[model samples]
Target: MITAIVHIDVEADRIPEVAAQVAELPGVTEAYSTTGDVDIIAVVRVAQHDMLADVIADRVSKVSGVVRTRTYIAFQAYSQHDLEAAFALGLDD
Candidate 1:
């Protein structure tokens, strides 16, 4: 799966509305309202690289109140479980 983390900026009054709208789009796994440089963070997962453009530029970017967006393509995913497993590779216990 291809995962894209999208940082979204929206009109000041439309944060919730924008987040809800983005969350409903195809390929969007989740959309969160957050406190930071951006208003919303959307997680998008797709099967093909070209689907990114369809989801981000074509769908997400066109949502009402969406001012701008910055998308990050995930190269690797690390979790606490994965970290522990890696560290235990050569251990006896």
Candidate 2:
């Protein structure tokens, strides 16, 4: 799966509305309102890289009040689920 972390900039008064709309888009796993330079952070999961443009450029970027977006493709992911499973391989407990 291709994992995309999208940082969104939106109109000041429409952050929540924009985030809610983005969260409902296809392949969008989650959208969160956050602090700092970006207003929303959207997590997208897709089958391939080309789909990133379709999702981010065509869908996310066009959402109402979304001024712009920047996307980062994840090369590696580290999570507790992966760590726990690896550590439990030969352990009795």
Candidate 3:
């Protein structure tokens, strides 16, 4: 699966509306309203790489209140257990 982390900016009054709209898109698995430089964060997952443009460009960017978006493609995913094991590797007693 291909995963993308999208940081979205939206009109001040439309954060909730835009988040909901983004979450409903086909490839978007989750959308959250957040505090910081960006107003919303969306998690997009698709079976193929080419589908990213279709989801992010064709769908997400067109949401009514979306002002802008920055996308990050994930190269690897590490679980909490994986992180712990890696850290413990050199600490064996």
TM-score of each: 0.86, 0.91, 0.85
Worst 10 residues of 2 by lDDT: 84-93
What lDDT score belongs to each candidate, Candidate 1 first?
Answer: 0.96, 0.95, 0.95
Q: How do the residues 1-93 of candidate 3 rate in per-residue lDDT, one tens digit apiece?
A: 999999999999999889998999999999999988999999999999999999999999999999999999999998999898888997858
RMSD of each: 2.8, 1.4, 4.0
Candidate that scores best on TM-score: 2
Give the TM-score (vs. native) of candidate 1.
Answer: 0.86
* Candidate 2 per-residue lDDT over residues 1-93, each given as its tens digit: 999999999999999899999999998999999999899999999999999989999999999899989899999989999999999998996
Off by over 4 Å in 2: 89-93
Per-residue alpha-carbon lDDT of model 1 for 1-93, expressed as tens digits? 999999999999999999999999999999999997989999999999999999999999999999999999999998999899999998996
* Weakest ten-residue segment in model 1 by summed lDDT: 84-93
- Taking all chains together, the TM-score of candidate 2 against the true structure is 0.91
- In candidate 3, which residue pairs clash? none
Q: How does residue 7 of candidate 3 score in lDDT?
A: 96
Worst 10 residues of 3 by lDDT: 84-93
